[model samples]
Target: MTDDARARGLTRMQEVYGWKPPEIDGAFFATTVDHLFAEIWSRPGLSDRDRRLLLLGALTAQGRMETAEIQIHGALHNKEMSEEQLREIALFLCHYVGWPNGTRLDTAISTVTARVRDGGEPRMRRLK
Candidate 1:
């Protein structure tokens, strides 16, 4: 992270966790966030499908439910994956991973679906 990211994270951390700092180690956090993810993950070469899959696997493995939900919405926003694709992924994880993980996916899907139902903004495009 540059000074900007550090400063921003600092302020957000203070706001969220009362300045205790995230459980993450500080030294590698900057490099990983600022360079590895920000630089590479933003590249156009990786399709939305690929990014969504990556995020689903990573977040599920790490048990990061909230971020995983955001990624589910983001995949939709990017026009990468469909609602069906998300359900399938989660369902697969359910069988291989466990029922609890499957539940996480269901929860995320419900949250996103409700957001759309509540007039969040429709972006689903039917495949012709």
Candidate 2:
């Protein structure tokens, strides 16, 4: 198990969608980055699939589709999740969170899936 999968304070915060700070300070950036991917993510309590779902829910609840797609792709890549699951999550979010939020999530998911189907990088995806 790597530290990226752990749940120290900052790590857990980054696991959440839209937690990025306006400016990057070396210590704060590394600390939060590690905390999200390592400490909290390191816990075995949640499966990768479930983690994706949780992030979907969080993004929807927060109405932040911009950051949500990263987790969406991460979910798809990590757990081999299908678009249907992402769609379902968007739908579920509509009920608990709000219709407007769901719409945004749906749009983001749809756009990502469209690009993927076209064999292009999803818009939210960063090129390496």
Runs of candidate 1 exceeding 4 Å displacement? 1-33, 43-45, 121-128
Lowest lDDT sum, 10 consecutive residues, model 1, at 12-21
- Prediction 2 global C-alpha lDDT: 0.65
lDDT tens digits by residue: candidate 1, 1-88: 4777655555543332222334455566666445544555546787656766877877876677876766676666655677888888
Per-residue lDDT tens digits for candidate 2, residues 41-113, read 6677877667777777887899888778777655554445788878887888889999999989988888767
Worst 10 residues of 2 by lDDT: 14-23
Q: How many backbone clashes does candidate 2 have?
A: 13
lDDT of all predictions, in order shown? 0.64, 0.65
Q: For every model shown, what is its TM-score relative to the native structure?
A: 0.61, 0.69
